[model samples]
Every structure is written in structure tokens, then in C-alpha cells.
Target: MNPPIDDRKEYSNNFLSTNSPIYERFSQHTPRCHRGFDLRVWLNNEKNLTRTTCFCPPSFYGDMCQYQNQRISLTIQFRVLSDSWSTLFAIIVSLIDHSKQRIIHSYEQFTYL
Candidate 1:
């Protein structure tokens, strides 16, 4: 026999839980809070259609907030030093901007003797 469904667990990507703060204050039904908008509307309002629009906050974008937005700039510098026994290896330097709307990702290696 098949197992019975569980009502406690919710599986909606678009709508928040019924107990969510936004839903409790602004909406009587589950609400959507992602992507480029936060949407809330009565599920039983088919007979009386209503329209609303909500925009996403900073660092958020896309139709369902499925992607992260960022801007990046990189700078690299190199230097070498000499030692009595042997020559010091080259050193690498990296500079990056980490603004609110920007992300920095990088990888590097350095060696010295």
C-alpha cells in the first residue's frame, strides 16, 4: 500500500509558507518572494480578478531570483627578489573590487626560495 501524504511539508517554489511574516501581514494566502518580485494574492479570487506588482530588492534579479548578479574587475602584478645563495622566485599580486553589486573570484600560485 502507498504511504499517505504529509500536510506539514510544503513544496512550492513560488509561494512562501502560510506562517511567513509577509503573508501574515500583507496577504491571506501564500506569497512569492524571489527573483525580481514578491507577489501575494488571494488564491480564490478567480471570480474577482486583481493585479499587483512587486520588485525584488538589491543583489537579486531574474524572473524567479534564479541567478545572482555581479560586476567584477581584476588587476595582477608581479615582482622578483634576489638572495645571496639563490634568486628569489617571482611573487604575484592580485587586486579586485568587492562592491555591493560586485563579486570577486580568483585563483593564484606563488613560490619563493
Candidate 2:
């Protein structure tokens, strides 16, 4: 005759629970914030479709690629920080033209450190 399933629990001395501290530590490292940019694209021609894409260097992150209609706008925002300081270094904004494939306007500011 076979014993019940619960009877096996007595043979094992060590049992792990779900609310362990290890579980908490794993969740803490997950990504909680998202940073990026918004760009606006205005196409000159109606028949031609325009596509825009952006590339970010090291220490930067944002939305790089986007599609446009008649008047398309994208916002790009990134967090800049210094190694020794615990504050933001600057903010950058880039306005691109998808139809012409070029940057129309670019701006940057370093107000706080």
C-alpha cells in the first residue's frame, strides 16, 4: 500500500517559504523608471512616407525610432548624471525632420548639478 502525499513532508526537515528575503532582493533590482525623448516630424510631401530613427551614445537612453504622419511630434528626454555628484547634469532635446532626414533643432541645458 502507498502512503498519502502529505506523509512525505515528515521525511524532509528543511522547507522553504515564498516570502523569503531572497525573493525581495530579486524584485528590488528590477527596472522601475523609463527615460527617453520626443521628436516632431513634419513631412513636406504628402505621397512620400517618412521614417525617423535616433541613436544614443553611452550614458544616455531614449526613443530613437518613430513614424510620422502629416505633422508628427516626438519627445526625447534622458537623465544625465555625474559620477561624483548625486544630481542631474543636463537635459537634451532634438527636433528632427523625417522627410528631409535631418535635425531641425537641438537644445541642451545644464541648470542643476
**For candidate 2, what's the RMSD?**
20.8
- lDDT string, candidate 1, 1-113, tens digits: 63444533433534687677987887665455555666655556668765555576677665556567765555655454544647656656444556885544554557766
TM-scores, all candidates, are: 0.27, 0.22
Model 2 lDDT tens row, 1-113: 86776776754433544576876787676332232233335565676655544444444445642322233366667565556566644565555656766867655554555
Kindly give the stretch of ten consecutive residues in candidate 2 with the minimal lDDT sum.
31-40
Q: Kindly report which residue stretches of model 2 are placed more than 4 angstroms away from their true locations once superposed.
A: 1-3, 8-14, 32-113
Model 1 lDDT on a 0 to 1 scale? 0.59
Residue 112 CA error for candidate 1 (Å)? 31
In model 1, what lDDT does residue 19 have? 78
Q: Give the TM-score of candidate 1.
A: 0.27
RMSD of each: 14.9, 20.8
